[model samples]
Target: MVIADLLGVAKVAAITLNERGRISHWDDTATELFGVAPPRALGRPPAALLRLPREHRGAFEPGGFGHVWCGACTLPRVDDGEPAEVGWWVYPIGGTPGERGVSVLALAADLRRLRRDGIGITIGDLLLAPPDRPAGDAAPARRPAAARLLRVEPALTEPSGDGADTFAA
Candidate 1:
């Protein structure tokens, strides 16, 4: 059965950034993903908290243009320095940074886990294509029917012996 028939990515962590590109909210998942708790992560710029790739160094900066930027990143855990491969999608909220400013929501997932689970996701799949503008404003890209569906293993669709018929991921 199709698990999801839409453009989306699995997110393992959620972080909210204020207009200044500083962490405003860090959820429990964020703590687990980055090993940085809210107490130490809040108010800190993403650059200071995570080691972004050279090309993506400006990922968290307010681009003045409100858009969704998604890709992969490798970051060392703040607590142990252990590296983690993370997939990310960053999008602005409220308005562009130049206008009234806005809060940005950043969602990340562990790539290793996604791969192990047989989820075929990629940056290109997430964006559909390199976005020319914010995901909401841009016209959806046209793609083959095969590309729109995510195939799920029978184990995920098969219900347990329990009375509830819920699909487990």
Candidate 2:
């Protein structure tokens, strides 16, 4: 199935942003969630459509596209009731840091739903989880290093009467 069809059925908004923060692919669910249809929003700067503040707009810099700039940004629902908190995932989409054609994918979730589901871990809590190392303090044994050079004597062409080949050092 096509990506557009997949996005439509998932009920999750999928937005693709260019290096300059312009909208590339604004899927169906994105239109429903943001109330800005593709016909009008495609190719336009995302900051303008979302009404992002100047300070926050810098988060879309090509190098910073996919890193989580703001874990949550509160905005009123389209119907205009209580504000909803939306988390953002920001990081560079295409190629390395300085390459062109970078894109950003923003996955937004309703904070209310998250709270109802008991998502309580803070960023610090997640980052500070116990380090994955053994608790024992025993030091490992070290093997002795071998000398790199080895000397060998030439073998004598004639064998000794004792039937042993003699080697001269």
Q: Assess each prediction's global lDDT (C-alpha) against the native.
A: 0.66, 0.50
User: For residues 28-123, could you state the per-residue lDDT of candidate 1 as single tens digits?
Assistant: 878988888899998888888787776775667765545778999787888998998898888877545433344787888777766754333323
- The CA lDDT at 81 in model 1 is 89
Give the candidate number with the greatest TM-score: 1
Write down the lDDT that model 1 would get.
Answer: 0.66
Question: CA lDDT of 128 in candidate 2?
Answer: 17
TM-score against native, each model? 0.58, 0.48
Question: Residue-wise lDDT of candidate 2 within 1-169, one digit each (tens)?
Answer: 1111111011235566776668777776566556667888888876766755466676655554345565667655443434656656555565642333546766555555545443221121121111221446233322212111112223424546796534422
Error of 2 at 83 (Å): 3.7
Off by over 4 Å in 2: 1-11, 64-70, 76-82, 94-102, 116-169
